[model samples]
Target: MYTIKYRVPESARSGQSARSEEKWYHVSILTQYTCTSTGASNKKRLHRKQYCIATTKSSQLENLRSEFGLPVVMDPIGNGNCQFAAVSYHLRQYGIHRSEETLRQEVVTFLRQTPVLGNRICGANWWTSILKQPRNNLSRMSTEYEYGDQITLQAMSQLNNMQILIVSTRNSATTLISPDGSSCLSSRYPLIILGHYPEGAGEHYVALGYKRHALERIVDKSAQVTWETDPPTSDDDLNVGGDDLSAGGDNLSAGGDDLNAGGDNLSAGGDDLSAGDDDLSAGGDDLNAGGDDLSAGGDDLNAGGDDLSAGGDDLNAGGDYLSAGGDDLSAGGDDLNAGGDDLSAGGDELSAGGDDLNAGGDDLSAGGDDLNAGGDDLSAGGDDLSAGGDDLNAGNYDLSAGGDDLNADGDDLNACDLGSPNTSDITRLREMVQFKRNRKHVHQNRHVILPREIWCIIVDIVLKLSPLSRYSLQRVNRMFRDLVGKTPPPRLYLCPSRFGDVTVSPISVRKIIALSGSGSGLVQAIRQLIRHSSWVNAWLFLRLATLCGWYTVEGIWYRRKRRN
Candidate 1:
């Protein structure tokens, strides 16, 4: 078993930031709760397969009792990696510790050379296989089940120079096997065990880093034995180091007259010197090299004959010089011009007239966007007009006038210009045409001429019915009879002797008559049939009835007329 420093925030006074305080705890693969002396009711526990978990709660140092609270087990919330955590905890117990990142790097380094481990790293299968053998030979290996104690022992043995061995079954023990073929019993120390229990199968591994004696002795108090390793003595073994120079100290030297005491001027000899005004002439010049003129512009004497004028302007010598004393013109360089209130002539010329002749060069121009010639002596008579330029003037022309006659329309229109029309006019125009058109009148009363085949079908249906139905269709109106006049109605003779024969009666008429009544019932039944049939069928039935009635009347009339 091993111990690691778990840091918790020390609760601060009101309105203060929390400070962190370190607490040493016996950490391993085994499930345990975190105990505090403040109250066991609020102390939370960690379950199996979890070595390090952070809590937001700021736990004070007072909550930990070295005897009972430090190694309290908490509820487990993680899945798998129990064996890895336990082995890691065991290493930490022996003063050799690796962080999670370092552990991952070591595993990757070990797996890279082993071709039989395939491309994957740190999965369940690879861990299981490595735990079982812990040797370089990875041929025909199986990484199926959870790693047992033997596999973990083998893996730990192969990991470092330290020898590790596991005791399984009835007397499960841990032994620190050494390199010199010597073994020491480590059962007193908490051992990481992998086993199945009554609660579940496929059991996970658990680690208890501290020894049994240490665990018992430090029961109620926080564990505080230093778990850090000392630094190695050899400088060659270190990756970084400091030089011989110490920090926070200056190392400088000054020699001879180069070192000034404390004044602005360097005065090494113990002579009184005036070091004010950033000048050393009083101390260095005993012969009065600057003389009494030093108090009044003495440096101007050695300034290449530069004058100290009252205006403080430098005298112009040559090369585009502007005379600062007066406005004296020079004539050598490109900008050799005199400076004054107004420059009449240099590279360009200028002239001004008194009355209204604002002339600069040779021409008195009658030109501008708004020209004004009160005397009307404008000479430029006919020139094409450019924008904003003066108009051409002829004899007795009022070209210099600035009034309504010169008001050229400034309302220039572009391609997308919209005219300023009145809002009321636009509204009235929209109201004159704004409405939905009446489409229902045209749709409701439209003429639709049907096809010839439909009319022929109506007549054909009228021809296939019995005489009684034909007479009933004729009673509908004259128009229906004219429509069915193309086809004659079917003759349906009712004879009780030939009732079952096909020629005696039509099936439709026979069924209607049979289903109805015989004798006087036939009349009302036939009338019902006329009402029930379609227009075409009733027309055909009426025609058939007319034929049958005519035959009977003709036979009776012929016999009576012959007897008379």
Candidate 2:
């Protein structure tokens, strides 16, 4: 069996950061575990293919120790990579062994300086097959997954210092997290945590470079990617250096699942996820979970524990590269897929005609509830994906939340801009209002963008807000400002009189036009409008009225619904 570890290097380059990241390497050993009432059903040990069996990772790991009769196993938490051993080596080489304390202080200084950002790199988790356990079928009397609750890195973010997972089994899918921020799942509140697979790692991984020879070479070749193969071996030699590390072949060690060779890709620090190959046929699942590049697929079919395909249910890729058909045939039930290219939830609850669809890919469609989000780069989508009560953010561009609750966490957002030539479905209420409004709202306003006709709705909403609010709106985003600037909102959207000052005297309009030209994000220059408007209210309507107006600062229109 093998294990992946990380080591710190004595070095330079200081910036505002600390804590480097480690890579999760797969060190395949025998499986061991503790039997729970749901042992065989654990999904953690299902790969054993033992039916009616129930066990835990602790049990599985033990079982392996017994089978192989090996006493030492690799530990990521221990003196990682034996790097400490090289300290003396370094001293001997530089003739400074006498200054050990100096070296230690130097290392500590490095960790604290601006260069050491607060552990910017942290190991993610290992990817395992979803089928490792008897997928807790949806039929079990005691069910887990529920409605309204989803697995989002953001939602899970509140689960700090914990491990979580979103997986599909036999024909069931669910997301589990440690509610208390402890790494255990509560079968009762499946939402709390998916529980632990026992043997699932509790340590961090440091990323080392991948083994560039035999295995990785072949895997890369299969994907049509070019790479230089060092001391490569032919395909017929799987057994040549398979178990023999000393056989002189560079091995792919992101161990638990094989990523380079279609297995589980290991997790490394720095939020760098080493994923297996996720495709229409297979997906990846995080046996354990952590930060960024948080979830994807495995190398081999389902190696990452995110089984991409629904067991050949049908062709899943819906021409979106991220969409595929997975039949969740349980009556009133659904098939859910969470990983694929360009798939996302827009951080909302997305449900398909079927049931749930969680995706990491984009430009896709689903029939189940979908939620695409994971701080700066999280994408969750599906036919009815709903960011209902959660975050729907696109840390960057070209992100679409096809179902509902399309939102913007930090970036100015485009909700349901799906009616265009190249967008996904705006399935919330099965309508595309936001989709259209986002497309067209860019043009109606003065100096704005005009792409489609639907944007008028947003323009309508923005128009109803107080002038100060409207001005502050520019600070929401540079892109939104740029786009909305091109496509002005519809003039009739708001009653214009709602804000009383929305259509102030002639000179005010020009001032607003000019203000619109100057800002992006959080109250920009328009924030000063609050001060100006407040004084006007004080002089005309009196202090109480001014306070009343200030209270509506979120948007004057928000106080009353926009006109039809």
Candidate 3:
């Protein structure tokens, strides 16, 4: 039904950015066809030309280089652990070198601890299924490993406080996961760029390294743009527009000379000249002419005083003549003068002039008279208003205005003028209003009314869910800092040894317990233990515990108790 053709780059140089070349493709489709019963068909083909870079590994790699300034892509072994390996490689740059397995364990632990996020990522039964196996065994099972998706990457981002950039080679699309799972594009967190390539089996991930300064500049610019063009909220629509207009007006006012030049041309031809004639007619002609002359003369006396004065007098006289002519035309004064005796004898023309003056005054005051009439109606409707209020207070009663029964067939007119309420009803209404005010005050200050014990319990639950969140709690307030300090640390456990594994000995356990009383002593003990033991055993027991999870004094105590 369709055929597609792609044009390769003109100069296909290895390691060169494909973005520099113009790329396009042609797609031909059979849009229409006519078929005959005689086994023959006539078809019409539609050809479409599209300008776009081909979605291939080479092109994507080139795009990454061009956009991110030649990031170094470190290919990890594609043995189903590529995602974790890539993450581990990137972490090494930040002085947080971790083995792939350790990283995987950490990811699994974090996902397990956060049930809401875990259930969303996998399924509600994900943890239940994994529970059948030992935690350590589950981490070691290669078949259990899942291909890193956006949700998993987001989990890792939140856990490590690191931002991840996933650039897909199969398509010209990139996904950036921020530390807080928000749309915020800027963060001080270390950025880890992971290149994703589609394989026959599945997708593979590789770490990408770039100049930190360039990345920082790009992030800062993006943040600046985001802040400058923030999405408008409800109030922002009116407030922001008003603020922007005020700012623009201020800027225009700052260049007052230039604005004044433009204003001078506009006022001289438009407002000043045209408005003078209109004002002269609207006002009594004499006063308007004198005002206009004085205003004009004050501004331009030195330039042309005599001409302005002469022009003012001539205009004033002409304005008075025009005013007299307008009155005569409106009232037929000339006709009345010519037929004076006849008009007086009839009395009709004199009455007609009076009627015309009355009509003009009525037309001018029509709107004001209507508004005053509406006010009078409103004042008369107040008794009906009290009847409606009484109905509302009666709970289930139907409205009956003016104490007339609404249910009565011929009582409609009587119901519209309910006079007033009694003293008891007024007192009850006041009490109801006061009760609502008291309830509102209670609800408004509910947080402040919470007991200290309740707050402590809430803090304990939070710390239990996330031990590292203690640092965040410390920054909340002095009271919270003290509470978090008083709370004991979460219990930790060493990884359960597999069957036939002989890694950790009792003597080594005692040495760790005795030395791990302080932070410095704990580091010294780990260093000495690693130095003496085989790399494999040391990695499994000490390094993995330190990297993937905490090794607690309780764990050491448990080991000692079990041996005894």
Top TM-score prediction, candidate number = 3
Give me candidate 2's TM-score against the actual structure.
0.17
The lDDT of model 3 is: 0.41
Lowest-scoring 10 consecutive residues by lDDT in candidate 2? Answer: 188-197
lDDT of each: 0.32, 0.31, 0.41
Error of 2 at 562 (Å): 62
Candidate 3 residue lDDT tens string, 1-564: 445443344555699755444333334321221123122321211111123342344765655454444374666655567788688766655545455555666666766666544224544433443434545433554232456555467667766556676655533345567644544433233457777765562477877765445444444444322211333333323221012121111222221222233211111211112222233221223323212533432221112112212223322222222112122212222122211111111211222212211111111111111111111111111111123222322222223333533221111323332333322243333334334445555666786755544566688788766555675788889878866764543333333441222235322444334434435544454444334443122222322223223442221212223564
- Model 2, position 116: C-alpha lDDT score: 16
The residue-by-residue lDDT of candidate 2 on 1-564, one tens digit each, is 576563433345597455566654454421232233356575655555444232333564454332222221321112221222122122222222322223333333332332212223542211121232222311221121111122222222231222233221211222323333333222211111121111233222111211225224233333222222333354322222122111012233332554352221122321222223221221355432243333344433333433334334332233222333442222112323343323444543345433354433333443233433212122222223444443333323223444444432222244534444223343332233334434444543548554422353365355455443444556777644542343222121112234344323222322333444435322343344344543322211111112222322222221233798
Query: Comparing 2 and 3 by TM-score, which wins?
Result: 3
lDDT of 1 by residue, 250-356 (tens): 22112112222232212212112222224332222221221222322322211223343224444434344434446543434323232323322232322211112
- Model 2 residue 146 lDDT? 17
- Stronger candidate by lDDT (1 vs 3): 3
TM-score of each: 0.18, 0.17, 0.25
How many clashes in each candidate? Answer: 44, 152, 3
